[model samples]
Target: METQELHRGRLIDHIQLVVRDLDASRAFYTAVFDVLGVPMGGTADDYFWADELFVSTADSEAAEGKLTGRHHLAFQAQDRAAVEAFHKAALANGGTDNGAPGERPYHPGYYAAFVLDPDGNNIEAVYHGEAKRSAPSVKVAF
Candidate 1:
Protein backbone atom coordinates (compact mmCIF):
# COMPACT_ATOMS: atom_id res chain seq x y z
CA MET A 1 0.00 0.00 0.00
CA GLU A 2 1.03 3.56 -0.71
CA THR A 3 0.46 6.59 1.51
CA GLN A 4 0.68 10.24 0.58
CA GLU A 5 3.06 12.55 2.34
CA LEU A 6 1.42 15.57 3.98
CA HIS A 7 2.17 18.99 2.56
CA ARG A 8 4.86 21.15 4.10
CA GLY A 9 4.40 24.80 3.13
CA ARG A 10 2.27 26.50 5.68
CA LEU A 11 3.23 29.85 7.22
CA ILE A 12 5.04 27.86 9.90
CA ASP A 13 6.13 25.16 7.43
CA HIS A 14 7.01 22.59 10.10
CA ILE A 15 7.73 22.36 13.81
CA GLN A 16 10.18 19.89 15.31
CA LEU A 17 10.41 18.78 18.90
CA VAL A 18 13.61 17.10 20.01
CA VAL A 19 12.87 14.52 22.66
CA ARG A 20 14.83 12.63 25.30
CA ASP A 21 13.28 9.31 24.30
CA LEU A 22 12.42 9.01 20.64
CA ASP A 23 10.66 5.68 21.05
CA ALA A 24 8.45 6.83 23.88
CA SER A 25 7.58 10.05 22.09
CA ARG A 26 6.87 8.05 18.97
CA ALA A 27 4.44 5.78 20.74
CA PHE A 28 2.70 8.69 22.43
CA TYR A 29 2.31 10.69 19.26
CA THR A 30 1.23 7.71 17.19
CA ALA A 31 -1.63 6.97 19.54
CA VAL A 32 -2.82 10.57 19.77
CA PHE A 33 -2.44 11.49 16.11
CA ASP A 34 -4.27 8.34 15.13
CA VAL A 35 -7.38 9.64 16.83
CA LEU A 36 -6.86 12.99 15.09
CA GLY A 37 -6.70 11.20 11.71
CA VAL A 38 -3.10 12.03 10.84
CA PRO A 39 -0.74 9.21 9.96
CA MET A 40 2.95 8.80 10.64
CA GLY A 41 4.39 10.02 7.39
CA GLY A 42 7.99 8.85 7.60
CA THR A 43 10.69 7.87 10.05
CA ALA A 44 14.43 7.44 10.35
CA ASP A 45 16.79 6.23 13.05
CA ASP A 46 16.52 9.52 14.92
CA TYR A 47 13.30 11.16 13.75
CA PHE A 48 9.73 10.79 12.56
CA TRP A 49 7.12 13.16 11.19
CA ALA A 50 3.39 13.37 10.80
CA ASP A 51 1.96 16.10 8.63
CA GLU A 52 3.79 19.31 9.61
CA LEU A 53 4.90 18.14 13.05
CA PHE A 54 8.27 16.44 13.44
CA VAL A 55 9.73 14.56 16.36
CA SER A 56 13.38 13.66 16.70
CA THR A 57 15.92 12.52 19.19
CA ALA A 58 18.42 14.91 20.73
CA ASP A 59 21.06 13.75 18.26
CA SER A 60 19.08 14.75 15.18
CA GLU A 61 20.36 17.74 13.23
CA ALA A 62 16.97 19.39 13.35
CA ALA A 63 17.41 19.70 17.09
CA GLU A 64 20.42 21.99 16.46
CA GLY A 65 22.07 20.21 19.35
CA LYS A 66 19.42 21.19 21.88
CA LEU A 67 16.36 19.53 23.26
CA THR A 68 13.34 21.79 23.07
CA GLY A 69 11.75 23.07 26.25
CA ARG A 70 8.09 22.61 27.05
CA HIS A 71 5.81 23.84 24.31
CA HIS A 72 2.05 24.07 23.82
CA LEU A 73 0.85 22.72 20.48
CA ALA A 74 -2.77 22.34 19.54
CA PHE A 75 -4.14 20.16 16.76
CA GLN A 76 -7.49 20.85 15.18
CA ALA A 77 -10.22 18.29 15.72
CA GLN A 78 -13.28 17.80 13.56
CA ASP A 79 -15.62 17.73 16.52
CA ARG A 80 -16.03 17.27 20.25
CA ALA A 81 -16.02 13.48 19.89
CA ALA A 82 -12.60 13.49 18.20
CA VAL A 83 -11.22 15.70 20.92
CA GLU A 84 -12.50 13.27 23.56
CA ALA A 85 -11.04 10.35 21.66
CA PHE A 86 -7.64 12.03 21.41
CA HIS A 87 -7.52 12.45 25.18
CA LYS A 88 -8.39 8.80 25.74
CA ALA A 89 -5.80 7.54 23.30
CA ALA A 90 -3.15 9.81 24.75
CA LEU A 91 -3.82 8.67 28.30
CA ALA A 92 -3.63 5.04 27.20
CA ASN A 93 -0.26 5.69 25.57
CA GLY A 94 1.85 7.17 28.38
CA GLY A 95 0.55 10.70 28.28
CA THR A 96 -0.50 12.57 31.40
CA ASP A 97 -3.65 14.57 31.47
CA ASN A 98 -3.24 18.32 31.62
CA GLY A 99 -6.89 19.05 31.11
CA ALA A 100 -9.90 16.89 30.41
CA PRO A 101 -12.14 17.31 27.40
CA GLY A 102 -14.52 20.22 27.84
CA GLU A 103 -15.43 23.71 26.74
CA ARG A 104 -12.60 26.09 27.42
CA PRO A 105 -12.45 29.73 28.43
CA TYR A 106 -10.54 30.49 25.26
CA HIS A 107 -13.92 31.37 23.68
CA PRO A 108 -17.38 30.16 23.10
CA GLY A 109 -17.41 27.05 20.94
CA TYR A 110 -13.79 26.32 21.81
CA TYR A 111 -13.70 22.77 23.09
CA ALA A 112 -10.30 21.28 23.83
CA ALA A 113 -8.38 18.57 25.63
CA PHE A 114 -4.78 18.81 26.74
CA VAL A 115 -2.14 16.26 27.70
CA LEU A 116 1.50 16.26 28.55
CA ASP A 117 3.63 14.21 26.23
CA PRO A 118 6.38 12.07 27.67
CA ASP A 119 8.71 15.08 27.45
CA GLY A 120 6.24 17.31 29.30
CA ASN A 121 5.29 19.27 26.22
CA ASN A 122 1.62 20.25 26.17
CA ILE A 123 -0.33 18.53 23.42
CA GLU A 124 -3.87 19.63 22.67
CA ALA A 125 -6.79 18.74 20.42
CA VAL A 126 -9.48 21.35 19.87
CA TYR A 127 -12.71 21.73 17.98
CA HIS A 128 -13.95 25.22 17.19
CA GLY A 129 -17.55 24.07 17.22
CA GLU A 130 -18.61 24.97 13.67
CA ALA A 131 -16.89 27.04 11.06
CA LYS A 132 -16.84 27.64 7.34
CA ARG A 133 -13.65 28.19 5.43
CA SER A 134 -12.75 28.79 1.82
CA ALA A 135 -10.33 25.88 2.00
CA PRO A 136 -9.13 23.39 4.53
CA SER A 137 -5.54 24.61 4.48
CA VAL A 138 -2.86 26.12 2.32
CA LYS A 139 -1.51 23.65 -0.28
CA VAL A 140 1.75 24.00 -2.12
CA ALA A 141 4.21 21.70 -3.91
CA PHE A 142 7.80 22.04 -4.90
Candidate 2:
Protein backbone atom coordinates (compact mmCIF):
# COMPACT_ATOMS: atom_id res chain seq x y z
CA MET A 1 0.00 0.00 0.00
CA GLU A 2 2.69 2.47 -0.96
CA THR A 3 3.77 4.36 -4.04
CA GLN A 4 5.94 7.36 -4.80
CA GLU A 5 3.49 9.12 -7.03
CA LEU A 6 -0.07 8.64 -8.25
CA HIS A 7 -2.69 10.32 -10.38
CA ARG A 8 -6.07 10.84 -8.76
CA GLY A 9 -9.43 12.20 -9.81
CA ARG A 10 -12.68 12.85 -7.98
CA LEU A 11 -12.86 10.55 -4.94
CA ILE A 12 -10.63 7.62 -5.70
CA ASP A 13 -6.89 7.54 -6.28
CA HIS A 14 -6.81 3.85 -7.25
CA ILE A 15 -8.71 0.59 -6.86
CA GLN A 16 -7.49 -3.00 -6.91
CA LEU A 17 -9.66 -5.99 -7.69
CA VAL A 18 -8.19 -9.40 -6.89
CA VAL A 19 -9.69 -11.92 -9.25
CA ARG A 20 -9.62 -15.64 -9.87
CA ASP A 21 -8.79 -15.58 -13.56
CA LEU A 22 -6.18 -13.15 -14.74
CA ASP A 23 -6.34 -13.80 -18.47
CA ALA A 24 -10.12 -13.50 -18.68
CA SER A 25 -10.10 -10.31 -16.65
CA ARG A 26 -7.28 -8.95 -18.78
CA ALA A 27 -9.17 -9.64 -22.00
CA PHE A 28 -12.36 -8.07 -20.70
CA TYR A 29 -10.56 -4.96 -19.47
CA THR A 30 -8.28 -4.60 -22.50
CA ALA A 31 -11.19 -4.52 -24.91
CA VAL A 32 -13.32 -2.09 -22.92
CA PHE A 33 -10.37 0.15 -22.13
CA ASP A 34 -9.66 0.43 -25.84
CA VAL A 35 -13.14 1.80 -26.35
CA LEU A 36 -12.75 4.08 -23.33
CA GLY A 37 -9.37 5.42 -24.60
CA VAL A 38 -7.43 4.22 -21.57
CA PRO A 39 -4.19 2.44 -22.36
CA MET A 40 -2.94 -0.62 -20.57
CA GLY A 41 -0.55 0.98 -18.15
CA GLY A 42 1.49 -2.16 -17.41
CA THR A 43 1.29 -5.85 -16.62
CA ALA A 44 3.12 -8.44 -14.58
CA ASP A 45 2.73 -12.16 -14.14
CA ASP A 46 -0.26 -11.77 -11.84
CA TYR A 47 -1.78 -8.43 -12.73
CA PHE A 48 -2.54 -5.72 -15.28
CA TRP A 49 -3.63 -2.12 -15.02
CA ALA A 50 -5.23 0.74 -16.94
CA ASP A 51 -5.19 4.19 -15.48
CA GLU A 52 -6.32 4.02 -11.83
CA LEU A 53 -7.77 0.50 -11.94
CA PHE A 54 -5.71 -2.60 -11.29
CA VAL A 55 -6.78 -6.22 -11.81
CA SER A 56 -4.73 -8.88 -10.09
CA THR A 57 -4.78 -12.54 -9.23
CA ALA A 58 -5.23 -13.65 -5.67
CA ASP A 59 -1.62 -14.74 -5.61
CA SER A 60 -0.38 -11.28 -6.39
CA GLU A 61 1.57 -9.80 -3.49
CA ALA A 62 -0.89 -7.04 -2.86
CA ALA A 63 -3.81 -9.44 -2.93
CA GLU A 64 -2.36 -11.62 -0.14
CA GLY A 65 -3.90 -14.70 -1.72
CA LYS A 66 -7.41 -13.43 -1.11
CA LEU A 67 -9.89 -12.69 -3.84
CA THR A 68 -11.99 -9.58 -3.61
CA GLY A 69 -15.75 -9.50 -3.36
CA ARG A 70 -17.94 -8.16 -6.13
CA HIS A 71 -17.54 -4.43 -6.62
CA HIS A 72 -18.96 -1.75 -8.85
CA LEU A 73 -16.65 0.52 -10.79
CA ALA A 74 -17.70 3.18 -13.24
CA PHE A 75 -15.51 4.79 -15.88
CA GLN A 76 -16.09 8.14 -17.47
CA ALA A 77 -17.11 8.00 -21.12
CA GLN A 78 -16.43 10.79 -23.56
CA ASP A 79 -19.98 10.62 -24.91
CA ARG A 80 -22.97 8.44 -25.51
CA ALA A 81 -21.18 6.73 -28.40
CA ALA A 82 -18.32 5.78 -26.10
CA VAL A 83 -20.80 4.31 -23.64
CA GLU A 84 -22.39 2.21 -26.37
CA ALA A 85 -19.00 1.14 -27.68
CA PHE A 86 -17.91 0.21 -24.20
CA HIS A 87 -20.97 -2.01 -23.79
CA LYS A 88 -20.33 -3.63 -27.14
CA ALA A 89 -16.69 -4.26 -26.37
CA ALA A 90 -17.43 -5.63 -22.95
CA LEU A 91 -20.07 -8.04 -24.25
CA ALA A 92 -17.80 -9.23 -27.03
CA ASN A 93 -15.07 -9.93 -24.56
CA GLY A 94 -15.59 -11.87 -21.31
CA GLY A 95 -18.32 -9.61 -20.02
CA THR A 96 -22.06 -10.13 -19.60
CA ASP A 97 -24.51 -7.32 -20.08
CA ASN A 98 -25.94 -5.95 -16.90
CA GLY A 99 -27.65 -2.98 -18.48
CA ALA A 100 -27.79 -1.68 -22.01
CA PRO A 101 -26.69 1.78 -23.06
CA GLY A 102 -29.39 4.37 -22.40
CA GLU A 103 -30.36 7.33 -20.25
CA ARG A 104 -30.69 6.68 -16.56
CA PRO A 105 -32.76 8.34 -13.81
CA TYR A 106 -29.72 8.86 -11.61
CA HIS A 107 -29.65 12.43 -12.91
CA PRO A 108 -30.41 14.41 -16.02
CA GLY A 109 -28.05 13.52 -18.86
CA TYR A 110 -26.95 10.36 -17.07
CA TYR A 111 -26.35 8.08 -20.02
CA ALA A 112 -24.62 4.82 -19.20
CA ALA A 113 -24.09 1.11 -19.73
CA PHE A 114 -23.29 -1.63 -17.28
CA VAL A 115 -21.56 -4.98 -17.65
CA LEU A 116 -20.37 -7.74 -15.42
CA ASP A 117 -16.68 -8.47 -15.70
CA PRO A 118 -15.22 -11.95 -15.80
CA ASP A 119 -15.20 -11.96 -12.01
CA GLY A 120 -18.77 -10.68 -11.90
CA ASN A 121 -17.92 -7.16 -10.81
CA ASN A 122 -20.37 -4.53 -12.00
CA ILE A 123 -18.50 -2.38 -14.50
CA GLU A 124 -20.00 0.74 -15.96
CA ALA A 125 -19.25 3.45 -18.49
CA VAL A 126 -21.17 6.68 -18.17
CA TYR A 127 -21.36 10.06 -19.86
CA HIS A 128 -22.90 12.87 -17.87
CA GLY A 129 -23.55 15.03 -20.89
CA GLU A 130 -21.71 18.25 -21.81
CA ALA A 131 -19.61 19.63 -19.02
CA LYS A 132 -16.10 20.86 -18.29
CA ARG A 133 -13.35 19.63 -16.04
CA SER A 134 -10.80 21.84 -14.34
CA ALA A 135 -8.21 19.11 -14.94
CA PRO A 136 -8.30 15.50 -16.01
CA SER A 137 -6.70 14.34 -12.80
CA VAL A 138 -4.60 15.44 -9.86
CA LYS A 139 -1.00 14.25 -9.60
CA VAL A 140 0.66 13.54 -6.30
CA ALA A 141 4.39 13.04 -5.90
CA PHE A 142 6.33 11.69 -2.96
Candidate 3:
Protein backbone atom coordinates (compact mmCIF):
# COMPACT_ATOMS: atom_id res chain seq x y z
CA MET A 1 0.00 0.00 0.00
CA GLU A 2 1.26 3.47 -0.87
CA THR A 3 1.20 6.14 1.79
CA GLN A 4 -0.72 9.28 0.99
CA GLU A 5 1.17 12.59 1.07
CA LEU A 6 -0.37 15.44 2.99
CA HIS A 7 -0.16 18.86 1.43
CA ARG A 8 -0.37 21.76 3.82
CA GLY A 9 -0.43 25.49 3.19
CA ARG A 10 2.19 27.94 4.51
CA LEU A 11 0.11 29.65 7.16
CA ILE A 12 0.87 29.20 10.84
CA ASP A 13 -1.93 27.89 13.02
CA HIS A 14 -0.66 28.69 16.53
CA ILE A 15 2.27 28.91 18.92
CA GLN A 16 2.58 27.79 22.54
CA LEU A 17 4.50 29.70 25.17
CA VAL A 18 5.42 28.52 28.65
CA VAL A 19 5.53 31.71 30.68
CA ARG A 20 6.17 32.38 34.33
CA ASP A 21 3.25 34.78 34.58
CA LEU A 22 0.15 34.33 32.46
CA ASP A 23 -1.32 37.75 33.14
CA ALA A 24 1.84 39.55 32.11
CA SER A 25 2.10 37.44 28.98
CA ARG A 26 -1.47 38.30 28.13
CA ALA A 27 -0.83 41.99 28.50
CA PHE A 28 2.33 41.91 26.40
CA TYR A 29 0.81 39.89 23.61
CA THR A 30 -2.37 41.94 23.68
CA ALA A 31 -0.46 45.17 23.27
CA VAL A 32 1.75 43.76 20.56
CA PHE A 33 -1.23 42.43 18.63
CA ASP A 34 -3.10 45.68 18.98
CA VAL A 35 -0.17 47.54 17.47
CA LEU A 36 -0.10 45.16 14.53
CA GLY A 37 -3.88 45.39 14.15
CA VAL A 38 -4.23 41.72 15.06
CA PRO A 39 -7.18 40.75 17.25
CA MET A 40 -6.58 39.15 20.62
CA GLY A 41 -8.75 36.21 21.60
CA GLY A 42 -9.20 33.56 24.32
CA THR A 43 -9.40 33.79 28.10
CA ALA A 44 -6.61 34.25 30.57
CA ASP A 45 -4.16 31.42 31.39
CA ASP A 46 -4.83 29.51 28.19
CA TYR A 47 -5.07 31.18 24.79
CA PHE A 48 -4.61 34.41 22.83
CA TRP A 49 -4.45 35.49 19.22
CA ALA A 50 -1.25 36.94 17.74
CA ASP A 51 -1.24 37.67 14.08
CA GLU A 52 -2.61 34.47 12.49
CA LEU A 53 -1.18 32.35 15.30
CA PHE A 54 -2.86 31.40 18.57
CA VAL A 55 -0.33 31.63 21.42
CA SER A 56 -0.69 29.88 24.77
CA THR A 57 1.41 30.19 27.89
CA ALA A 58 1.91 27.74 30.71
CA ASP A 59 4.17 27.42 33.74
CA SER A 60 7.90 27.20 33.14
CA GLU A 61 9.69 24.12 34.40
CA ALA A 62 13.33 25.09 34.17
CA ALA A 63 15.70 24.58 37.05
CA GLU A 64 16.63 27.45 39.33
CA GLY A 65 19.72 29.66 38.70
CA LYS A 66 19.97 28.51 35.10
CA LEU A 67 19.41 31.04 32.39
CA THR A 68 17.43 30.27 29.29
CA GLY A 69 18.28 32.20 26.17
CA ARG A 70 15.71 34.34 24.45
CA HIS A 71 13.03 32.76 22.30
CA HIS A 72 12.41 34.34 18.89
CA LEU A 73 9.13 34.73 17.03
CA ALA A 74 8.39 36.69 13.90
CA PHE A 75 5.19 38.00 12.40
CA GLN A 76 4.45 38.99 8.84
CA ALA A 77 3.57 42.61 8.18
CA GLN A 78 1.36 43.96 5.42
CA ASP A 79 4.08 46.40 4.43
CA ARG A 80 7.07 48.40 5.59
CA ALA A 81 4.75 50.97 7.18
CA ALA A 82 3.02 48.32 9.24
CA VAL A 83 6.35 46.97 10.44
CA GLU A 84 7.44 50.43 11.48
CA ALA A 85 4.14 51.02 13.28
CA PHE A 86 4.51 47.75 15.15
CA HIS A 87 8.02 48.63 16.24
CA LYS A 88 6.83 51.99 17.54
CA ALA A 89 3.92 50.52 19.40
CA ALA A 90 6.09 47.85 20.96
CA LEU A 91 8.44 50.49 22.37
CA ALA A 92 5.49 52.45 23.76
CA ASN A 93 4.11 49.28 25.37
CA GLY A 94 7.18 48.53 27.46
CA GLY A 95 9.06 46.46 24.90
CA THR A 96 12.73 47.04 24.26
CA ASP A 97 14.06 47.59 20.78
CA ASN A 98 16.44 44.87 19.63
CA GLY A 99 16.70 46.12 16.07
CA ALA A 100 15.20 48.85 13.94
CA PRO A 101 13.33 48.51 10.68
CA GLY A 102 15.77 48.33 7.79
CA GLU A 103 17.14 46.28 4.95
CA ARG A 104 19.22 43.16 5.42
CA PRO A 105 21.51 41.54 2.91
CA TYR A 106 20.89 38.12 4.49
CA HIS A 107 17.44 37.97 2.97
CA PRO A 108 16.56 39.65 -0.28
CA GLY A 109 14.35 42.71 0.21
CA TYR A 110 14.01 42.00 3.91
CA TYR A 111 12.71 44.93 5.91
CA ALA A 112 12.02 44.20 9.53
CA ALA A 113 12.13 45.38 13.14
CA PHE A 114 12.82 43.47 16.34
CA VAL A 115 11.54 43.95 19.87
CA LEU A 116 12.09 42.22 23.15
CA ASP A 117 8.87 41.40 24.91
CA PRO A 118 8.26 41.86 28.63
CA ASP A 119 9.32 38.27 29.23
CA GLY A 120 12.51 38.72 27.20
CA ASN A 121 11.09 37.02 24.15
CA ASN A 122 12.29 38.30 20.81
CA ILE A 123 9.51 39.40 18.52
CA GLU A 124 9.81 40.74 15.00
CA ALA A 125 7.64 42.25 12.30
CA VAL A 126 8.98 41.79 8.78
CA TYR A 127 8.21 42.74 5.21
CA HIS A 128 9.96 41.33 2.15
CA GLY A 129 10.87 43.90 -0.46
CA GLU A 130 13.78 45.77 -1.97
CA ALA A 131 15.68 48.10 0.31
CA LYS A 132 14.30 51.60 0.23
CA ARG A 133 16.49 54.71 0.34
CA SER A 134 14.38 56.41 2.97
CA ALA A 135 13.10 54.37 5.89
CA PRO A 136 11.44 55.43 9.11
CA SER A 137 13.75 56.45 11.94
CA VAL A 138 13.27 54.38 15.11
CA LYS A 139 14.79 55.31 18.44
CA VAL A 140 17.02 52.76 20.11
CA ALA A 141 17.90 52.42 23.76
CA PHE A 142 21.58 52.00 24.58
**lDDT tens string, model 3, 73-128?**
67767689988999999999999887898875646878878787999776778787
The C-alpha RMSD of each candidate to the native structure, in angstroms, is: 12.6, 14.0, 16.9
Candidate 2 C-alpha lDDT tens digits along 34-134: 99899996659898888878788778764545443466577888899999999999999999888899998757999988788999776788888898888
Report clash pairs, candidate 1: none
Q: After superposition, how far is residue 51 of candidate 3 from its true place, in Å?
A: 18
The TM-score values for the models, in the order shown, are 0.52, 0.52, 0.45
Q: Count the backbone clashes (under 3 Å) in each candidate.
A: 0, 0, 1
- Give lDDT per model, in order: 0.77, 0.80, 0.64
Q: How do all the candidates rank in terms of lDDT, highest first?
A: 2, 1, 3
What lDDT score is found at residue 76 in candidate 3?
66
| Model 3 segments more than 4 A misplaced | 1-69, 130-142
Residue 2 local lDDT, model 1: 56
lDDT of 3: 0.64
With candidate 1 superimposed using the best TM-score fit, by how many Å does residue 134's alpha carbon deviate from the native?
Answer: 1.1
The residue-level lDDT of candidate 2 at 37 comes to: 90
